[model samples]
Target: MRYFEFILILEIGILLLLSLFGKKLLNRRIVSAFVLVTLVAHYFLEGIRWQMYPTYLMAFFILLFYNHDFLRKRKWYIKTILIFCLLLLAVSGAVAKLVPVFDLPDTTSRYAVGTSNFTLEDSKRSNRKLNMKFWFPTSKIGSPDGVYSENPVQTLDGLFDMPGFVFGHLNRVETETYNNAEILNDSIKFPLVVYSHGAASSHLDNTGLLREIAGEGYVVLALDHDFSFSDYNLKKSDAMTLEYVAQKAFITDLIDKVVPNQVQDIEFILGNLPNSNYNLVDHINFEKIALMGHSLGGTTATDASFNVQGIQAIVNMDGPLNTASIEQLELPFLYMSSFSPDISDKSLEEKGLPDAMLYRRVKQWELENVYRLHDRNTIGFHWVRFRNAGHMDFTDVPFMLPIMKTDSYDEHKGHLLKSSVILDFIDIHLKNGKNYQKVKDQSLEWIK
Candidate 1:
């Protein structure tokens, strides 16, 4: 158990002790003060910033129940309410600890396929570098270990600390440790997938999902945008350097402006294969390329499909549309969101793009194939709402944070649901003939 878990258990014990000794503890201001202090400490240690409201309420009730003189004066109904509150606190604490938070499958293999860099002459002058890895299936029936970005620990530390801020405590894992060589040559010609990460996030964020796809006989290519969500190694001068700040600012500014230009970059990376350093030239079925991205990366994927020729399908995992490219889209596309379409509207508008625009644009694409999944209609565009999925549901980090209990984000469910849906769609349009009936019949939801 981690330090957090130990602390949680300790808190539960305290609550139990208070509940059992309420009569004796009544009128003891010092004990009440101790409880209050512990509660405050709990909040800080657990990082429960938003969850403090309910925690405070529970603590208040614990204090009220322990004051027996006041409880005796109250009516039976009031006493029952106090008992119920105590029960609620007990249940909440148990639920917090007992619930299996993030769902991640055991990873089986990892592979470092290739690496390359691109020079962005359009906006900020810099080299866009990428160290792409491919995780493949090694066995027919076995759970695989989860994959991470070339630098797992660093990525997590960066993600947890703040966007764009790199902390010294962050740890980075060896890329080879997450790379699987045995499965590199598993298939003669596998399906192709191009992945783009979120803003300030590296392509390594979705290693679990990427590896799962590769294991299913697909060559997944993940690229890092120059000056966007990537870390650059530079020599330092006396610890504090204007050059470092300038470099960081330059990258941040690049990501802000590059959203629109990413379409071209995607094409530049895909069309010019040799430039990408991927050696699956003989293994890739160029005609069956699929584009995918998360958050801001999702917008890139959507826009790139319009610019990148020969792409059969696209998947946008929670990325709102970029107004510039939405109207020009001309391929089969899938939009998977954690929240309902309603919540995504503001993000769409902020980007000067909205789902209404996407809907119309998709309609214009008229590829003779389109599908939607919502929270209401299971058979139509709306599928069942994944009860507890958060915005980070589409990525792999939620699965790796074992102590952070997230009941709604199930790795197996997410992996099976997302992979099965994407694979089925790609298989039908890119590899097999159109099978709208399968998607409509909800057959894609079932996964082995």
Candidate 2:
């Protein structure tokens, strides 16, 4: 929580305690004044959050009920209602304070991060509209603010039966990239990294990691399949690859059915990105392309490396590789999975499933990638799991929506590990990182 918010919650909590148990120390006039003052500060300075309405109402209730004489005159039901309201307030207030909006730590790279968006309709006969969300290194260090795109609560609302405003507050979570900041004019080019989101997720899911890597002079392009912005989340999985395979499909069906569509998404980006006239294109090194994705996006990245030419490496962030994509794709792949125990508990408590399905999916993806890495059939591959993180932990959703984030997973620790390791891998393959061995770990066991 931010400092002002912490103090506000703390003071309000103290006032509540004094009102309930410190009758001997209570001064009605002073208590009334204190409640009024706190409410004023909350609305004007601290910013009123939706979940804390109960807490705010509690202050108003205290003002109405603090006087014993006035309370004695109130109808029995009114007093009972006030009591019930306090209980409700206490519960919501606790949740509000507990699940505070978290700030992303500053990027460790030297370059400033900037983001820009462009729209294109592929002309490849099967042409489709695509939204390209790109984060690239800029000449300046912190030019301006950039939009983070999708809000987790708003994005997830249709998937669940919850009220919309319950997560409206998540929209307040922000990113540091200056929108379309001027690209650096250096003659040398930067490596390309294509990122894809999980099923029913947004390209904006991994902002912290994206910004960190982009700041280090990589051109990160995340493709937003229009389905992600539509009501498809309620109808199907975000990653089309996971939907059709459905336990009954043959590998032929998958190759002809789903993988082609994902590959099409990548091809369109690669097709338009170089000539789209965006300033960042000046720094694109097509020969150094690397693919990264979460969930089904990983499937797309894996497929692209196999089907498309010039993709140097791959990073699959906890995504399952469909039979079709894994069969033909064997590139330098990085398998980053979150096998944390906290993930299982949250999944069970929230979705009523054990999350064992995730483990199964991880094993499936790892086995394929490990085979390529160990056999030297591929360039290189690494499989590392975050023991304290869940599938959601791979992205920035947990950090923005703390309720979705668990206490056990240190978001920073997991992010740092992934960032340093992936950056090193990208550098070793796409740029220049002869020190890749320095990032070796005993804890992050590699299959090869």
Candidate 3:
């Protein structure tokens, strides 16, 4: 919770307790003035969120009921009001805790991050429109006042499967990237990292991570694939639930086409980068390009690495290699999977069960990549798992919608591990950068 928000809520709770147990000690005029002051401070300082509306209403209720001698003297009326206030407080607190303001960790690099969006039309594929954002190293000094996402309404609806109005306050969330800031123009050419979001996700899903990478002297090109922005409503449902089954067949059919289309999108963007007018492209080191993505996007990166030439490295964050022929991938590859020992057949033995079937395939696909990495010829390959982490833990979805959380690992800590590990991997492979013996994390277990 934010500073003034916590203070306001706590003060109200104290007032409620005093009304019940110590009404003689309660100062009605002083309490009313303090509540009004706190409410103003919370509104101006922390910002008002819909989740706290009930609590805000409760403050007004206290002003109406507590200040009135007739209502206060009637014990039954007071008890009824207290019960209603308790319900309101519970609802408000729960919602507030569930969807708290998601402030991303600060960028830890010397360079300030700069981001800009571009629309690319693919001539070969029916003039398919693709949106991409460039997060690049910037020489600009001031902190960014820009909002984190461009399409918060779409993000809330598509990513979290929630009504846009519930989290409309997210539109006010600030980020660390300056919009269209001047690209760092030092003589050194920056390594390019093309990032792809998970299926049914936005390029801005991992905005925090992309900014962190850009701050570390890399040009991070985040792609908004044609399928992710399509009319498909991909609910964030658990694999074990009936909701997933209802959507499974449709998702399967669409995803088969989605992966190939995304690979084409990546290829098109990479092929056209040099010819493009974006200034950030001029600083890109074409020779040192890396493909990185989450979920199905990670699959696309691996697939693209095989089909497209000049990709120096690949990073797949907890994405299954379902569509990718990983055996053909020859570049430096990093596969990061969430810790899921229960994915094994022994642990989840219901082989024919619909939920288990999907789980099995995902686990099998991840295992295939892990097995390939263990091969003697597969050099520059790393497989690591975040302990007690879930699939969406790699993305920003969990921060905004905690209901999506499936594991106990801290999301903030997981991000730090991801940023540092990816930075070290790309540095070593793309920039011939530092060599870490192992990325030191208690939860991040290195498996070969």
Candidate 4:
């Protein structure tokens, strides 16, 4: 909770206690003014959020009762009113705690971050328009309020199958990047990192990490795939349920189409980026381009490195290699995997679990796929496991909602470690940086 938010809640709680206990320790007029001033301060300082509406209304009612001398009646109704006000205060505090206005972590780089959005159309595929967003190093200096998205509530509502207002607080969240700012005009061109988002995720989902990469002097480009939340095509119940693998043939066919098409989209973007009017376009060094993605997009990146030429390296953030076409990867590959519980049939039986056969099959396939891919790539394969991470940890979801994180997950440190490792990996391969040993996190380890 923010400073003034906590203070307001505490003041309301104290006021309710004093009123309910028949204590006249403070002047009624003074109490009224105090609450009023606090309310105004909270509104102006923290901005108005819907979670505090009840608290505001209750404060007004309290001042009205005090000013009208209704509290002097000493009747049972007075106690009831005070109790109700206390309940409202609790509600306000709880909601405020649940939906906080979060701030993005600081970008650990010398360069300031700038971002811009653009769109591209693929004529070969019925002119399907792909939305793209890019982040790059900027010489501009200023900490302007950053936006999560122009309309994240609607997209997140559909993606999570929740009411739009559930994420309305996100509208107030701030990031660390400036929009449409001038890109850094250094004489040297920056290496480009092409990013692909996961299924049911948008291109800007990893904005916090992408901004850090850009701040570290790389141009990062990410795209919204056809399966992205804005254009989500798959039914969550059918594809995300425990019975997923039961429809293996159906889902596999869909992914087979999705991965290749997304790869084509990446290639198309890279091919046209040089001709584009973006300020970063002239400063991008296409010869040292790297491919990176999360979940299914990670698989797409790995697949694209083989099909596309002049790719320097690949970073697959917890993406299972279920649908990767080639068995061997010759390029520098970073496979970051999230922690998953072992779901063996014996363990399931011992734990009295239901027979979710399809779920078990899907997990088995993923484990095998990762092992096979890692084992086959004898050269330049780096694997790291994030101990307490969920699939969405690699993105900004954990930073947004407390419920999205595991009980043991350290959101701040986890992201910092992720950014550090990714930077180290890309720097070594793409920038040809020194190979000195660096500090490593115990939760994250090199598997190969």
Candidate 5:
């Protein structure tokens, strides 16, 4: 249990004991003051969460009743109310929040990180307003808000049509990235890595990798295409056509609409960064920009790589590109995948542990996408499929909840291993020229 939770449990115990004997201690100012002080301290310290209001009311009411001789009932009903309040107060703190802390990785360089958000118009898609998030290297580390998102459970609950508690403590996850840290002053230009999230996900979906990479002295920007609570349009899920699901009309709509919409979002970020008023723009080496994302966002990254002039590479995490126009693609690429389609079910029940339906979909998706990757005759692409990682393992969701993690490999180690591989690939293509064949041979299964 967390410090706050323990404190809450103790406070509830004291409150129950006090109400029964509060009348005896009423005239004693110090004891009365102590109880009242603890009550206010509890709420004020956490900054007055709305969830604590009921407990606050009950505690204060108990105090008022005990102090007033007329209202102080030595009756069964009074005891019942006190007992009820005590239980409610204790339970509130337990199920209230997780207050997650980021397990920040040690950096190779002395690093500083900063973030900035931009809202712009999506001209192609009815000029809808869009939001962008950025994480960049700074000269001196700055103080961060620590929170990555406000209420993730509610946002995803509505989208996935699942219970909110599936991701309980989702809102409590704190980010280690500093809020608008001072931009690095060095003259050497830094490579820019633009991040896109999976469909029905926000810019924060891959925050763990983004922060880790930013610590390695790269400028990372995670754009939020749909960062609102008002009925998220999950149309992007249809953006890529799986061989089994490609015949549906919605798949066509996905190709024509959602794919372009995401590609445009990446382009918009690239276009806006050159003249961006943010101090870090001076450090961005526009000629060495790259795009990466999970799932649908990966597809977007691949699409962006096609037209974007200065892009040095594209990193797609378990997401297949929707376009059949991969023949002419010249950009260097990094493709990471979960278990392939051919893996057996017995192996899956022990390793992946996803629901039966999800496992089926993943296998089929893998079959089609793997075929696509094979058909593309590109010297620049390096595809890696982890031995036993679940589909969510490529992203941060599994790491967020240890219980939910069913991947055969440990989530953190797997992610760290992947991040190291990614940094090496970027080092070779974007910054310094390095041989990746050795590292690739040992750590990854070379696909095609």
Candidate 6:
């Protein structure tokens, strides 16, 4: 159940209340106006289009019934309004039932060294912390199907003006199915890749991408940036209020701080993993470590490579470069952007941050081995524009939202294209041999 569904139930309750207390509030135009306003607000705010017509009919019933005392005298108008409202309600109910509400193909895989609560001391601050979950390939383990966080429902509830029933039902619901890791013959140490999610996003937000990368014989370590994007309980606010604040800050200063902090977190994880009780060290080919992130996380990947030693390559998935940070980075880097110069001017301004500033900054950091891709560039970049892609498309939420008939991605095709491009870029840069001719052979469309 979502907040919108709760609104529907609330509306039903209101209708019942109106029936019981009609005579008491019959003369109160303010009450009627308040109901009407709430209906309109629900329609626009929750995308509950079907509810509008029925609500209008309900309003008509209240207006007509309140004026006439005898059913015999107002039989025609009363009956007509009742019939219309019932019909509209029935149709709306049918439409809601038939339409898909959410759609993310759930998947999971088992690992022996799937440790949690691996804490690291923050280098920059006192009494600070970082936590990570390492899912390394394992053998002979009785791992059940995995489950995703209940945060999404809580998040939707907080963001939308929906009811508690919808969100409360989803709180901490496990929603993923895991399978045994795919076996490989003559298994050797796998490549290591550190994953960073966008601001206000949880590590589980990109499970679809993480599982895919892990399935490809790479150890994908996702870092949870404290106070950055993961769930935070504000000392003064309630749970709902805190969630709202966290979601809003996800794209703002919260992300900016998370990006740099993620670098430190990754370095800590890597240094400690080799010596921890968990056998992650034996599974990873540390020499081939790569860093990747979506949006702000992508920027962090770029910056981390400079700060963290032994990071061979970095991939930025639709993430803009910080001009100051880019200058310091010297490793092989790949910039995968959805924007193109031909698309709407709204692209650069709306996507994440200012494009002109990012463009000028990235240009200064462009090295001979650096590869760049943008719209319609088949050889190097994915064939899509930033205008069509939402910042959320690169994650697994889009797929799930589509199935549940929730508002996730603007377009399914664009989301698929974005994910595919990101997977391919990772494959090329992380899995494939470094100094591969493909990077140099690619053409560059230098946008001024």
The top-ranked prediction according to lDDT is 4
Q: Which candidate leads in TM-score?
A: 4
Q: Please report how far candidate 3 places residue 396 from its true position, in Å.
A: 2.7
Model 5 C-alpha lDDT per residue in residues 1-448, reported as the tens digit of each score: 3344345456546656666554443453554565577666654554444445555665566556545553356687777777777777766654443323234344344475666666667576688666767777765544556455555555455333345444444445456666756667777888999888876566776777887788787888888766322333434344343434542444344445566777887777678768867666778889998888887688778888877868998888887557564664667888888766566667767774534445566456544754676667677678777766766777776655444566566776777777876887887888867667524434356675
Question: Estimated TM-score per prediction?
Answer: 0.53, 0.78, 0.84, 0.86, 0.76, 0.55
Which candidate, 1 or 3, has the higher lDDT? 3
Candidate 2 clashing pairs, residues 3+ apart or interchain: 200-238, 295-319
| Model 1 residue 132 distance off true place after TM-score fit, in angstroms | 2.3
In terms of TM-score, how similar is model 3 to the real structure?
0.84
Name model 4 segments beyond 4 Å from true: 71-82, 123-127, 154-159, 226-233, 243-254, 340-362, 434-439
Deviation (Å) of 136 in candidate 4: 1.2
Query: What digit string (tens of lDDT, one per residue) describes model 1 on residues 199-298?
Result: 6566666766776676566677776653323333322231122343443444334334666656666776676674444445566777788898986688
Candidate 2 stretches with Cα past 4 Å from truth are: 3-46, 59-69, 72-79, 97-99, 123-128, 141-167, 228-259, 340-377, 403-408
Better of 4 and 5 by TM-score: 4
Q: What lDDT does the true structure give each of the candidates?
A: 0.52, 0.66, 0.75, 0.76, 0.65, 0.51
Q: What's the distance in Å from true for residue 170, model 2? A: 3.5
| Error in Å for residue 176 of model 6 | 6.0
Q: Report clash pairs, candidate 4.
A: none
Candidate 3 runs further than 4 Å off: 17-22, 63-66, 73-78, 123-127, 154-156, 226-255, 340-362, 403-408, 434-436
Which lDDT tens digits does candidate 2 get at residues 1-448?
5554445455556655544443343677887787777677756765666777666666666777766643443466655655576577668657776656556766787788878877778777456777778888887664455645445455445322344465556545567677767777778888899987655456676889988989888889888754332432132333223432442233233334554576788887787678877767777898898999876677677777765667888898876566445445566778876653334445534432244464445345445644544465454657776655667878886666666674466777777877988888898888866745635644364544
Stretch of 10 with least lDDT, candidate 4: 347-356
Position 97, candidate 3: lDDT: 84
Tens-place lDDT per residue, model 6, 1-448, is 3355445535544553544433343444655565566656655655443323454555556545644454233356655654555566566554444432334443333333232335566555664666554444434345434444434354333322343233332223333323334323226887788888665465655665665556555677777664322233232223134243443443334335555666666777777677777545666787778888877778778777775656867767666566566345656565654434343445444544434444323332332113222232323322223433444566665543433322223544544444444445556665674333322111222231
Ranking by TM-score: 4, 3, 2, 5, 6, 1
Error of 3 at 389 (Å): 2.5
